[model samples]
Target: MTRILLIGAPIAVAVSVWFGGDGEPQRPKDDPSLRISRTAAAPDPLKAGTPEQQRELEERIDALPPGLADPAKKEIAARLVASAENSTLDWRSQYGVIEDIGDGNGYTAGIIGFCSGTNDMLQLVEHFTERHPGNPLARYLPALREVDGSDSHEGLGAPFEAAWAKAAQDPAFREAQDLMRDRIYFDPAVRLAKMDGLSTLGQFIYYDAMVLHGPGLGPQGFYGIREAAMAAADTAAEGGDEKAFLGAFLDAGRHVISRQKTEQTRDSSRIDTAQRVFLRQGNMDLQTPLEWRVYGETFRIDS
Candidate 1:
């Protein structure tokens, strides 16, 4: 059996062969079960080239204008996400926020909208309980688990909501939320965007998508949306135009948002008005003072 791969400037390829006992290449006639594998082994469309190329990409990303990870840019990212999540720039104010919002995910709470119907809220509480023994929300673990996949408030109600609000007051709880947000969303989004050779604006775009869509690898999840975008246009790391790739990425995100069949999910102003505005204005680096609208309300981040 032989495998042949074609290597290009940014893609890799190779070829291999299996010889018979006679030391000659096996053929269909020589062996009925013999098989030949031919494949197009290209570099990951979402990743840079070789190790040295990846290193260069990382350095270039780090040297670019301060990205989402920068203290200022990160704060700006939070505000941008908050505008869509809470309709306010005061992200910290959302720490104590908890409500069902009729989204079918059960109680949506905290800064990143962890939903009880989804497994993330369970993970968030589990993480917090692990760090701080017997926290206010620990007792609701059973109920949270029970309602992990439905909109039922079977075992959680006012008591659970009150406990959540009370837990929010503790600095430790707030810190736990921040840690989980970064662990589950922020860090992975930013890291992947950088590897894709995206600019600061791209990093923010990825983070925003992660916030709205869970980090799941499913077809509608954050990574799936990215994959769809890559299918449309090569990522910057793949030697494609950054603007084009980002535009495709935004389009993919919008498509996923539109399919949810909910009023709130149907409104993709976060990408349409906000991100597209920046993309249209050619703010790939995401340099501010910036202004955009979401849900018909305008927001700004000046520095």
Candidate 2:
């Protein structure tokens, strides 16, 4: 019986190996291509410092030198502010400045510049809003869409009317009434009629409205300037003036997009970052962290 059981076990083992065996499948054993080593290891728990130690570290950082702060930092910030405030400039020119200032700066410096610039722009906008309370263009011009039509009187008239109407009721309206009246001389219809010859001052005023209010204001302040430019280009094209319409079209399109892009980019990169960090951390100035770095660098405060 023992012999028979041993013989049966061998047969079972052979069948299992051929089908589903308990043992893992064996493959050709080649020399190991790589080797690894294990070293003695133990967990090193993270060290916890006392509250007093943290306070001491903070105090030491507060003693650093201010010269450690980057000079280009402030310059970048000032330029960002200036660009937003001066959005009346041609888009190409404004974009160039943005591109120059934004290139190759640390995130913190960029944040500083962007926040400063946006703050300046907001201040300027507030001033305009206060000064021209009723002017829709002054208040809401930034929200207009880009101008697109000939005889398009859509964006240009309403802001002026709103401003004038509000000013008329205010006691101080008489003081700057004449200037305001003069500024609003062209109603939307009139402005559309003379779109071709719109003065540079007109363009500036229109752009200023857009910048202060928002870019979406479209052509409310500018009237038919876009259309006339397009018209001139068409005429120039028909007259075989290759340089005329094509140049005008490209130039106008480029200027509009470039300026908007730059302003938006600057706003996003600088203003948005600064505001988030500043508001999140409370109203701390850029100088605080800067001072901390000075102490750490000179006296090894962190060390």
Candidate 3:
């Protein structure tokens, strides 16, 4: 799957309501058009260090408090991500959000923005079909697979978009999206950040990068960026200052963002005006009453 937005909260419970209008799923007129970056991959394995070093890192992480995983903080993360991804705080309203947005990724849809051009959208539909056979979007599996890795809508067009919208009306489908999102993005990002001995803010930084760059091992993917950052500075688990490591990570993320030619991917405001602002304030715990801008739009999560 390509660059998509996964609202960084446990959504299984939150998505159990109707998100469509009059039996149809429509994007709110006022919601700005969605613009996403690009690809999703399988979760990266713990291969950053030697077995002994990895074991030590695991132990160190096991001793830290639950940071981003905490329910309250997770809500904040969701809104923060929504501000950049959907341009609104009503993340639940995005259960049915779908469009190509002409970023060369086919049919970015659902709360996670699963792209038909990427592998994740196929997996999501497949997973949903497994749970509920003959679902509305099931017939398009072949087309999804055929179009994977590129922005070709070959066999899927209006029929496929309608099918996706129809499927979005199902709470089961919504729950499936949530489940796949956690499995593919959220859970792994948080787990890796914890292993890195990152605090709440650091964990969030990793998650945003993961959503934007995917979990691949490529030079621009989340793991590669982490590797590049670690090369510049040690992780907190490696006995380095948390702030320094996070700064290095943001620098690495900015570099990756800048290299992408797409207008969406090239924008680093998600890091520059959002996450980096928190870092500058030393809000390592990500305390509330937060304010930041992404894509030149300001958002806040006060509690």
- lDDT tens per residue, model 2, 75-174: 3222323344332212122211211133221110111121112222223224446876654335434422222112122443445334434534444433
Q: For residues 1-303, write the lDDT of model 3, one tens digit per residue.
A: 235322222211101011122322122233222111122432235323345544544454445566887889888887887787788888778888788877777788888678887678888988998888889988898888899878888999888888888888999998998888778777777867775667899989988887777776666777767777777776665567889989999998899778776787688898889998999999999998999998999888889
lDDT-better candidate, 2 vs 3: 3
Whole-model lDDT per candidate: 0.73, 0.26, 0.72
TM-score of each: 0.80, 0.17, 0.82
Clash count for candidate 2 is 22
Q: How accurate is candidate 1 locally (lDDT)?
A: 0.73
Candidate 3 Cα outliers beyond 4 Å, as residue runs: 1-64
Name every residue pair that clashes in candidate 1: 5-14, 105-117
Better of 1 and 2 by TM-score: 1
| Best model number under TM-score | 3
- In angstroms, give how far residue 90 of model 3 lies from its true place: 1.0
